[model samples]
Target: MKAVVLVRTRIVYAATAFAELVLWQVPKPVVGCTHRFKYRLAYVVDGTCVLRYDNEAGKGDHRHYAGKERAYGFSDPDKLIADFQADIARWNHENRHP
Candidate 1:
C-alpha cells in the first residue's frame, strides 16, 4: 500500500455570494469519479452548505447543491475550480445576489 501524502490547498471567499470555500488535493482523487484526484471542494453560504464536491470516505465523488446531492465527474483541478465558480455564479444569479 502507498502512503497518502498531502498536496495542496485553495481557499476562496466570495462576499457577494456569502460563501467560503476550502479545497484540498492529495495523491489520489476520491473514488467515485473517473478522475485521479478530485479530492474535495466545499462552499458554505450563511452557515448552510450551498455547494460541495467531494469523494466521501467510501461513498465516492459527488456534488451537493442547496441540500440535494448528486454524482459528479472531476476531471482536473483547474476544471474543478472553474466548475465551482460557475455553480456559484448560477446560484447567485438565481437568488439575485451580488
Candidate 2:
C-alpha cells in the first residue's frame, strides 16, 4: 500500500517502512502536479542505508550504516513536516510560470 501526507500544494511526504523508503516531493508550479523535486531516503533495519536527495540527481547521496545505526536518524516527526513545507516552496519556485 502507499501512504501520502500532503503539507501544502507543492509538498508531499510519504513513508513506507515495509518498502524501506521515505519519500518527499515538491511539484512544479506551472506543471502543478507533474514535475517534481523528489527525494527518497532508503534503509534496512538490520542492514545498510542510503539517503538520496534531488541535490545530486539520481546518482544519490549515499550513506552506509551497520545494524543499530540504521535506527538513529528516523525519529524526528516535527522536522519532517517542516522539511515538507520548505521543499514545497523551493520546488514551486523552480517550476513557476514565466
Candidate 3:
C-alpha cells in the first residue's frame, strides 16, 4: 500500500502567525515510530516556528517548543492535535501581545 495523506492544511491565526499541519497514513511505521501515522505540526509567529510536533525517522515522537525538545506520548491523531493547540495557546499567552 502507498502512503496516504490524512491531513494537509494551514490555519491562519494572524497576519504574522499561522499553523501548518501535515499528516500521513503510511503502510507501516517510520524508522523509529511504532504507529502507522506520520505527522508534522507547527505553529509559527513572526516568521519563526516556535512550536512543533513530529515523529521523524530515527527520532520517534517528539515536540519542540521554546528552543527545547522533548519526547511526546502520542495517543491518537485527535489527541495529538489537541495537545498541539494547547501548546500554541500557552506559547501565545506567554509571548504574544493580547
Task: Name the best candidate (by lDDT).
Answer: 3
- lDDT: worst 10-residue window of model 3: 89-98
Poorest stretch of ten by lDDT in candidate 2 = 10-19
**Alpha carbon deviation, residue 37, candidate 1 (Å):** 1.9
Which model, 1 or 2, shows the larger TM-score?
1
Q: After superposition on all CA atoms, what RMSD does each candidate show versus the true structure?
A: 3.5, 16.8, 0.9
**Please, what is the whole-model Cα lDDT of each candidate in the order they appear?**
0.64, 0.32, 0.93
Residue 43 CA error for candidate 1 (Å)? 1.8
Clash number by candidate, in order: 3, 0, 0
Using TM-score as the measure, the top candidate is 3
Per residue, candidate 1 scores C-alpha lDDT tens digits across 1-98 of 34342334544455523444445544554555454553556666666667887777667767898778987766666777788779888877886666
Residue pairs clashing, model 2: none
State candidate 1's TM-score: 0.68
- Higher-lDDT candidate of 1 and 2: 1
Model 3, 1-98: lDDT tens digits are 99999999999988899999999999999888889999999998999999999999999999999899999999899999999999988998999633
Ordering by lDDT: 3, 1, 2
Question: Candidate 2: misplaced stretches above 4 Å?
Answer: 1-75
The better candidate by lDDT, 1 or 3, is 3
